[model samples]
Target: MEIRKSRMADLPEILKLYEEARAFMQETGNGTQWGTSYPPVEQVETDIREEKSYVCEEDGRLAGVFYFSEGPDPDYAEIYEGSWMGSGDYDVMHRVAAPGRVKGAGSFCIRWCAEHSRRDLRIDTHRNNLPMQHVLEKNGFTRCGIIYLANGEERLAFEFLPKDI
Candidate 1:
């Protein structure tokens, strides 16, 4: 499997993945996390234009998608019920998703991002998103705190600090 920057042409496939992700989350009893219209198409388009969108491919077919950007994700500016590990800079990952076809795509993307990141890496998921929480912790991320998204929803935040960087 390989992870690469996503292009506009990948939009349709990416949307499908997000739709499948919402359905999967609902099936797992985490329906409120993404709601019905999460990660709208316009946002994906902007991520593509700004070069933040990414996709994981296995044997030449798209398997997963995510958004990565350097943080203090404005929404993360004020954490509640906990605090960040440090005051240093960090990168934030968001909107990770994969269809059932990709067995390890989520973990692969998280690992790849951490290995390539220049500073501490951060990500947040809804409290009930056990799958994502597992992927983050398995790849060396530690639960840092609870943060509210811009929409006022709560999320469990995790961070991965680079060993020597």
Candidate 2:
């Protein structure tokens, strides 16, 4: 699989992938994480416009999508119960979703982000998202702590440092 910035042309397919991922999460007992309509269309469009959206392609087709960017991410500023693994500049990965048909696609996206960022990386997931927690662990992301979104919803935080490689 290959990873690249998303194009406007990929919108329809990318939205479908997110839908499938939402269903997959529901099936895996993680429905509340995304609720419904998480990562709304407008947000996705904004991500694309800002060049922060990316897609993973397999056989020339989009297999997964995510939002990644350099951060001083405000949402990650205050961690509780634990602390980030490293300080200074880091990149963040968010809204990672795949159709679940392609094995390793999610892991690939996470590792690709880490490899390309060349800096410490941070990510978070709903506490109930066991599959994502497993994938994160598989990709070398250490459980950091908890973070609260702007709305005050808590999420489990994880981080991967360059030296972890």
Candidate 3:
């Protein structure tokens, strides 16, 4: 699969993928990370416009989407209860969505983010998101502890540094 910048045309597919992910989460007894109003269309549009969002294509079909950004993410600035792995520049990944067609999409996305960024990569997920936590751990992301009040809820944070490479 190849990863490329998301365009306006990919929005619909990305939305569908997120919906599928949400359904899967619900079926697995995991609370919805995006909730009912997650990933507003406007956010996707903005990410596309700013070229911070990306889509993964496998055999010419969109398989996944994610937002990669450098520097501090405003929402993640005041992590509660735990500190980040390092204090310098870092890339934060958000809104990663993958279709079932690709089993390891999250790993691919995380690897891409690590390689694309010059510094560390950090991500957070709901405490109940076991699948994501497993993926992160399998890919060498260390658990840095918990952060609260993002998207109106608490989350477990993970950080992958250059040393983890």
Report lDDT (CA) for all predictions.
0.87, 0.93, 0.82
Best candidate according to lDDT: 2
- Per-residue lDDT of candidate 2, residues 120-139 (tens digit): 99999999899999999999
For model 3, which pairs clash? none
Stretches of candidate 1 off by over 4 Å are none
Give the Cα error of residue 16 in candidate 3, in Å.
0.8
Clashes of each: 0, 0, 0
lDDT of 1 at 115: 87
Candidate 2: C-alpha lDDT = 0.93
Model 3 segments beyond 4 Å from truth?
none
TM-scores, each model vs. reference: 0.95, 0.98, 0.92
**lDDT tens digits, residues 1-165, model 3?**
789999898888888888887876777667567676578889989999999999988888888899998868776677667688788988889888774758787788878887887899988888778888888899889888777654577788889998778
Extract clashing residue pairs from model 1.
none
